[model samples]
Target: GDARGAGRPTGERSGRPTGDARGAGRPGEARRDSGYRGTGNPAADRYAAKKSGAGKPRQKPSGPRAFGGERFGKDLGPVRRPKAARTSRPADELDMHNPDGVRLQKVMASAGVASRRVCEEMILDGRVEVDGTIVRELGVRVVPSEVSIHVDGMRLQLNEDLKYYVFNKPRGVISTMEDPEGRPSIGNFLKNKNKNERLFHVGRLDAETEGLLLLTNDGELTNRLTHPSYEVPKTYYVQVRGPMGPGIGAQMKEGIELEDGISKVDSFKLIDSTPGHILVEVVLHSGKNRVVRRLFDAVGHPVERLVRTQIGPIRLNDQRQGSIRVLGRQEVGHLLASVGL
Candidate 1:
């Protein structure tokens, strides 16, 4: 007999033990030792036990996870946040139904007393009276042609038939229609042209200064054109007493501080140069009295002569001095449109 199968049962070398070696040895000893419970063959029994997991340990059951204090698989509908509050005023507080009339300050400003802002301040200070009653409230509306407005006890009238004219004002003639000293006035030009209408000059040129001067009976148009808000540009040909330095034009354009306010020029350029004198063209929008002369005076070079060549869209091209001419319909329309009428 072979040594490996010395103590085994018969037919063990052929991979099949006899009946007693398979299950007839002990009570539960054959099942555990042979690794096969129901099969009679020992090799067959070992193969069945390995595939069925007969010796493996079992795992324990676990619970589901928690999300926001609720079960992970449960539904929670939609999430919402609160709305913010509004900050604007209520609709009832606004004056939606405004009456149809021009503002009191606007009418006063158009009458040439002062600017709109200054007129408003004047009204609030009780210096203005409408139809014999004091009007201190703002936004008080009235038809200027229908109502009688007085400032400091002097009544104002609105001329309906608006007339516009351009005059080449000569030197040494007063800008006013009548001068208290009985000097040569603009009225002489109007009389020569046979124009008998009462007109006020838009802005004044000093007796010594000469050039284009606008005469109009339209108070509203006059105010609009002269007001600083409109920014109506005026061009002048100036002759200064000394030779201008290289940067004098830049200095003028930059700005100059005067007693009344800060004056600024839109542009300045040299037109001609002579011995001890320089002629330059300057453009500005200021309606202040003697602004052109004052600006040159502020600099070291005083103005020897000043002539306004243009006002807004109107120009004094080839117009003879001391002559007056009525503005055409197209020119009048253009002037009004330039200043927002």
Candidate 2:
């Protein structure tokens, strides 16, 4: 954006800007009411202004600067921008009213949707929805926490009470917030963390196991994710002794009997292998404690190292171990929708 301005001849930096000629070193600078402009050079600017009849009276434009602060061809009169394609509808048709409630634009802006004015345009353009219904009205009022808002069909989470985070749980660290045995726990990473109100780990990862562990204060989401009924997927990276036999993945997908129950992997992939050790990926929805280790043990491979790389829609990705990262709006939205929250 600055490249064009940097190379501009009439910029504030191109020689002295203060002179008898108004806006010296500024090229094509003209009043909205007047088309006559300055062309940088003092003598040339005076001549051009005189030639264009700079002093002639002009009609003031009555509306927005949609003309891009300069004139375009007269044919494209007042066309704003290319909004996303959606069925055109009258905003006033939907009469969602709560006089005491906050404005829709305010809620959207607070949720990081966009600036207040841009949000208004989005509402007017029919890009925002509330409670499964498209709402184009700018004055629509509803409680941010109560309504399910979506922008362009992506869910927007607006509950300020809820917080979401992803932590890379390194090996040797206990999963609990506070360890009674005085071992390194999740609390260590949160020492300087200011937002500790009701912050809870979503699920458990054994002290020896490591990788992505979702942390959140949203109780309902936590319960739903860990609950067996929802069957939220969790993926793990397992390191085990190599020269492993084939079809272990098939055997897993088929069924593997355990003391508690007959559990099976949703998916399995051989990530890497060598004679000494091998890395494999295991996906399952079971929340059983130490399930990954037991799965490998049942297959006669025995897990040497284990890492929970992903939990449902959230992935560890490139985050460094022992670090905590806040889940963004999109991530939180998908997470909430995963279990129908």
Candidate 3:
């Protein structure tokens, strides 16, 4: 009785267990309490047990210490193998609106069917049909497995063989396709040419001037070659109505001051001379509008006829004023070598 507490009253519940039948003294059994007599509720006994055991210390389960020790396991069991890459996530996909995706016009152009812009116009005109259905939208995308595209009712195929050529264009042809004013264009020379590859001029050539021009379907190469900062050399043969004096060549080489600014020729030389006419060669790296004509005019020798004779290592080579020949691989290589390509 004295072990219960000092000077405790008789039969008082001391919030602890005495050696009674309810106090089973087992590992998981609850301790007995005189205050809980006749309660017949196991919930209150379980709650009391949980509250008492929570005050006791606890031990962490087996694993490396989350914050302190270096007990990381040595089990090398292939690490649950990262959940086998899901096929639900696609490897690659084509987006119709993306510029680099499989675009309708570019697909037609690659098929040797027509120029991209022309194909676009054809789609708008309902001339281009895919798998027997007309596709008039601009950004319609198609994959190789999903498309059987046709232009003008004929199946199309992509041409892989790239062709590059240089043309020493003559005057009287506009650079564009079907000019609004209905003037003749250099494209006439390319029309119905029995060539498999469709040709496109890299840069513009004005109606009244002539010079070396590059033509190819290789857009990347065209972009690189025609960029103005490349400053590729272009040589011209100009005939003036009057003899250009000796010092005139020097002054032109030194850059002729025009109404706009100092217009310059890279080099110049008098080739042939007559009392009323002078034939001279002028070299320039500029593609400015009528630059050679403007320079000659600035120097008091308005050009009577202007013909571009050479561009880089390419020459006109006796080809008629309105003819074109495909450039050989070696020639293309030489051009690629130029401009530090």
Candidate 4:
């Protein structure tokens, strides 16, 4: 029924069949061909396309695209940009976050040569130089890398001093190099000074109070001991104007109120007492100004004489008055332990 065996000129049959003539007998079929047909019948072309593998399996879109309907043109939504590359920076650039750099005056003050202001004077006087060059500026940055800092041509090792001495500070001796009013200072009592390294006092002993005081050139240690959070304990021997009755102990233990607020005594003991005066030992952990004098004055008594016997775990020991002794390594360790350093 294909008409191929009749050899009716395979040209017409093999090329394209005349679908219009074939559909003439079928009126409804000719209407279907007229919708999309060109010069040749679209139904014959569609049949040929199906036979030649045009109707092969088609892949379904997946994920977000599976739900998206057909669209025209290329997708032009945002495209991610690559991250920029990082470059190295120089060491001189300040972090601005860290504040560990020591100030110029403080470095000089800690070196034991002078106060911060005095060090500036010395620097301006052409006495301070760094790495063989005279530097007269205040707050000149100096790293602890042996940058070769010197005062008046004498090479100064800012941290090499390691001096730690306890002075049985005598009354009338101000705890400084030279008093502004020309009064004799603690430096007057010190003999055989080392010119290479400087020395400075840790804390002050008033001009009229005789007690134990430590001196050092270590700035870091000085900062730590003086830091309020440390709460370093100080023991004082007080000579008051009246006999310390049992009520005195209770009042001291309860904390006495001063003008500033309550002044606390960690512990107190009545060492010896007379009807006219009492010798009491008080232990406290405050760095408030003139605390012992104020506490006694609060309790209807006055301190006739006060002497500091201990700082933290360091005691004056048998070191006599007017004598200076360096704190031993073990003693320094005990001091660190007292403040939980």
Candidate 5:
């Protein structure tokens, strides 16, 4: 049986020595735990540990000087418990009920998202949020048009009164909703639409020049879209009577002096060319009367045809002439965000 430090008591301790008592004796040797020298046989190990006065709890040894040292007893410090994980309050626990507002499910149904029963289930499954907070309670209520809502991560427009549409105004159709002379106007195209609700054309497309025009009942949106401060770009596909001269794009982009102001294209790209004509795309933020026509006239190339293709983030891609199309929910969201609405 081993006989090293056998008489040492369990509770007693001292400064770290060159080697622990369980290790084989050699004054200058590094300390090793009992496991390093232990025999594979359990019975033999037990007998040896019994003789070596081990298998009893001893004082925790100071860690290496590298851990926290300049002193003999300094260690890595006490094992600490981590901060408690933050937990959100359960949906049902928060006060979501609004006695005066419409029920959440009903609002969802009214917005054409789903039927009341399905919307309720969706809420209970945590698929609905009101102003960024998930709502699971069936009794929650919100003013239909006052709060921002989302289902399955897509924003839902709750205001039924507000409507938006993109109209493909064919050439020669007046941009106004109605004209006294009974010429082809926007009103003629909307005769079959809901008659009671008033709609406003967002911006004008002159009687002879037409393409994409926005129509909506959202008055504030209309005002901002027309306001020059927003500088919303409009893209046009233009055809001009040209011998296709060089530097026209650069000169137009640099700015063309007119009676109103120095007008310029944000971008000018040559699309196609032939012996007698040039077709190009021009983007600019100017909302002046007959701006495109005058810009081309200044450059000595008369505008043969002009068709606006885009406004802000809205595109008039392949829409049939004189057809009216409703804006999708995401499209409306993007439109609203474009003007900081």
Candidate 6:
């Protein structure tokens, strides 16, 4: 009987069960069914069939419909993004419209009253007067020949004939024009020439370290040449106490922090080496006091003797020690051009 049921057509078994199999249906139902048990009323049977999903299993959506096309409860549409702000024009692109006459502080600084920054401070403090009127405002431009500038009740005398000189500063000679200790100074070398004009040294070399020194009456050029902002390279020949190790040059070139600030050598080259001493040529733009000596001392190799061989375009090749000579027009021009003067 089980073999016969298995071989029977699916329609015959699906319709109704016979005899004892009919007992599987509920008491009120007329037939046993695989899905929803049908009621006698046609409308009720149709409702039951619809509620039970009488035919095939429900299928999911195929592609995009699986994910509802909505974001944060709103229908997704074209995305709106913000635009970037426009940038300002570069400095070079701006119009080149400069006012006439020299800046007030600049003129005062050029007259050897003080450095540019100090002159600005003086102006701000109401210590500077122009044309008999107290002018504290910066950026006030005036012609040197026309205006009367006074600092601390003393009138400034603008030096029309600015002179530039290269002096081979000798050892034991101070770098200043005057010293309270009555030490031999650069003024001793400049006495014969420009007797009345006051000149200032561009940079300083210690009394024991002798080399090329620039003396100028042009305070503006002095400020530009010596100011760290210009980064004018100064070359020096340094003799240390012992032979420099192989990695010393690399270390110096990298940089070292000192008490004042970090110091870095732009270029370092080992000139000669011996068991007793090491000679090195170092180029740097720093204008710190005793910077070269401090750098060597920091590396455990104290500098025995140091000499500045070059400053920007100027060189102290064969200039006799204790001798001073006026810089040629071409040399002066080159030096000025080096600092964008």
Look at candidate 4 and tell me the lDDT of residue 312. Answer: 85
lDDT of candidate 1 over 112-226, digit per residue (tens): 6788999987876778877676776666777676676767655554444777789998899998888899999988767644456778898888999999999988888888988
**lDDT tens digits, residue span 1-341, model 2:** 56745754563554444344464355765433255445557788667876766644666674444433434448755546455565644444555556777999998888887899999988887798888887867768887767888887778888877788899999999988888999999888884653456688988988899999888888888899989999999999899998888899999999889998988899999999877999999899998878878878999999899998998889999999999988998898888888886
Best candidate, TM-score? 2
Model 3 CA deviation exceeding 4 Å by range: 1-160, 193-198
Model 6: runs farther than 4 Å from truth? 1-160
Off by over 4 Å in 1: 1-160, 192-195
Candidate 2 ranges with C-alpha deviation above 4 Å: 1-95, 115-127
List TM-scores for all candidates, in order: 0.52, 0.70, 0.50, 0.51, 0.63, 0.53
Deviation of model 2 at 200, angstroms: 1.3
List the pairs of residues colliding in candidate 6: none
Ranking by TM-score: 2, 5, 6, 1, 4, 3
**What's the lDDT for residue 296 in model 5?**
93
Native-vs-model 3 lDDT?
A: 0.66
Predicted candidate 6 versus true structure: per-residue lDDT over 98-195, tens digit per residue: 24778888988777677899998887777877667676566577778777666766666554587988898888998888789999987777765465
Model 5 per-residue lDDT tens digits across residues 275-316:
888899999998898999999999998888899999998999
Model 4 residue 68 CA deviation in Å: 86
- Which candidate's lDDT is highest? 2
Ranking by lDDT: 2, 5, 6, 1, 4, 3
TM-score attained by model 1: 0.52
Evaluate model 5: give its lDDT: 0.79
Clashes of 1: 0
The global C-alpha lDDT for each of the candidates, from Candidate 1 onward, is 0.75, 0.81, 0.66, 0.68, 0.79, 0.76
Q: Model 3: per-residue lDDT, tens digit, 1-341?
A: 65766675444355543345344435674543334442334568657656656324566754435433455447643223222332321213322233334878877776555689898878777687665667667767666445656565555533336676666677788875456777876556665653445667876767788766777887766776677778878888899988556688788777766666777788888799888998998888876778888888777888888888777767776877776777754465456556544
Task: Output the lDDT of residue 128, model 3.
Answer: 70
